[model samples]
Target: MNAKPTEATLADRHVLYQESVQDVEAEIDFVQETFQALRGRDAELLREDFCGTANTACEWIRRGRAHRAIGVDLDADVLQWGIDNNLARLSAEQRGRIELLQQDVLTVKTDAPDMILAMNFSYYLFLGRDELRSYFRNARLSLKDDGILFLDAFGGYEAPMELEEPRECEGFDYIWDQASFNPINNQMTCHIHFEFEDGSRMDKAFSYHWRLWSLPEIREVLYEAGFRQVDIYWEGTDEETEEGNGIYEPSEVGDADPGWICYIVAEK
Candidate 1:
C-alpha cells in the first residue's frame, strides 16, 4: 500500500526548491554588480517578476537597509508562504522594505524600479511573440529611465531532449525532467521532482510549459520593445570540471555547450 502524504511532505517542496534550485545571493550580486557597472551607480530598488516564494526579494532587503524590493507573482499561496517562511525571518526594518503582490507580471504596476528581474527562465512562460514583446514593454515602463532589466535563459543542444537529469542533494535527489518538446513550435514541458531517502518521491513538485526562445529572437524582441541596448552575460567554466564557475561577464559570443545558462540585460 502507498503511504499517505503528510503536511510536512507538502510543505517541504518550497524548502527543497530553494535549496536545490535557487542561488538568491549570487543572483543579487549579479544584479547589483551589473547595474553598477552599466549605470555607474548602485541600484536601490528592485522588482522581481514571477517571484515565486519571493526568496530573491527577501534576500534583496537583507542586503542593505537602503534597498527595497517588490515581488510580483500570480500565485497568492506561494507569496504568502514566502511571507511566512522567508520574509518573517527578516528584521522589521528589512521586512518594511519589501512588498509582495499577487498580480500578473505583465500588468501589475508599482513604483518605477532601478532593476527588474525575471530570473530562472520564468519569463519563458510567455510563449507568444506578441505576448513576450508586451511583457518587455511593460517591464520597460515599470523601470526608471536608467533602470536595467535582468532575465536569465537556458538552452543548448540537449535542452530540447526528452530526458531526465537527477542530482543528489544532501537529503534528497533533485530531478529535472524534460517531458515533451515540439521542434516546430519550440515549446517544451518540464518538471521538477524530488526523491527522499525513504524511497518516497514528490513527483512534479513544479512544472513549466515554456517556449524556448533563442538568443537572437530574445534580442530582437527586446529591441522591438524599445530597449536602447541589450547585452548577454555569459558564464565562465571551471578549468578542471568544465562546469559553470558562477561568474558571468558581458560577452558577444557564447561557446556551444550541451546545456548552458546566460543572463540577458536590457537597458532602457
Candidate 2:
C-alpha cells in the first residue's frame, strides 16, 4: 500500500488562511452596522480592494438578498481559486450577486458602491506617500457621493520587531514572522507559516514586503485624498480579560498596547 501524504503537503494554504486569518462574519457585521450608524441607511453595494480570495465578498452577498459586492485584485490565480472554492460554496443566486475582477485596485473602476473595504493592511504595500495617496484618491473617486471607505491598520511597539509569533489553530499552528525591518524607511518583510501536528511544515505560505505605516500618516493621506472626514475606530477592551472586546467605536484617544489593530473610516 502507498504511504499517505503529510498534512502540510495535502493541505491548501488558502483554506488555512481563511480559517485562521479571516473572520468574514465579524467583518461583515462591523461594516454593516457601522455604515448604518454613519450613513443612517443600509448599504447595498460594496467593493473590496485587494480582495485576495473574495472570501469577504461572498460573505457580503450572504448577508442580504439585495446586497451586491465587487472584488478587485491583480492576482488572477487567487481570483480563480476563489471562484473555484469560496464562490462555489455560495448558492446560485448568491454567486450571481458578486463579481471578481482581475485588475489593479488603483485603477479598476466599477459601479459606484455605497462603501469600499481595504482591509487586512493590504494598502501597506505602497511604499511611498504619493503612491498611497494616489490609490486612496482613486478609491474615493470610485465611491458614490455619500460613500465611505473602511480600512484596517495594525501597529504598536512590537510592530517593527523581528520575531515569530505562533498561535494554535484547529489542526495546525499559524506562525507570523517578521523577517526584516528597516527603521529608516519603515519597510518590513513578513511571512506566514504553518506547522502541522504530523511534523510537517509549510514555510512562507504568504509573504509581504510592506511599509509599517503609522495611524497619523494614514489619516493625513486620507485627508489629502479629498475624503471629507476620516475617523479611527479603536477597539474597546474587555473589562474581564483586559483584551479586545470586538467592539470598535470612533475615538480620539487609544491605549498604547504592545500590538493593536484599528479601523480607519473615511467619508467622501
Task: TM-score each candidate.
Answer: 0.96, 0.99
Return the top candidate by TM-score. 2
Question: Tens digit of lDDT per residue, candidate 1, span 130-169?
Answer: 9999999999999999999999999999999999999999
lDDT of each: 0.93, 0.96
Model 1 lDDT-worst window of ten: 3-12
Ten residues in sequence with the least summed lDDT for candidate 2? 100-109
TM-score of 2: 0.99
Model 2 over residues 1-268: C-alpha lDDT tens digits?
9889999999999999999999999999999999999989999999999999999999999989999999999999999999999999999999999999999988998999999999999999999999999999999999999999999999999999999999999999999999999999999999999999999999999999999999999999999999999999999999999999999999999999889999999999
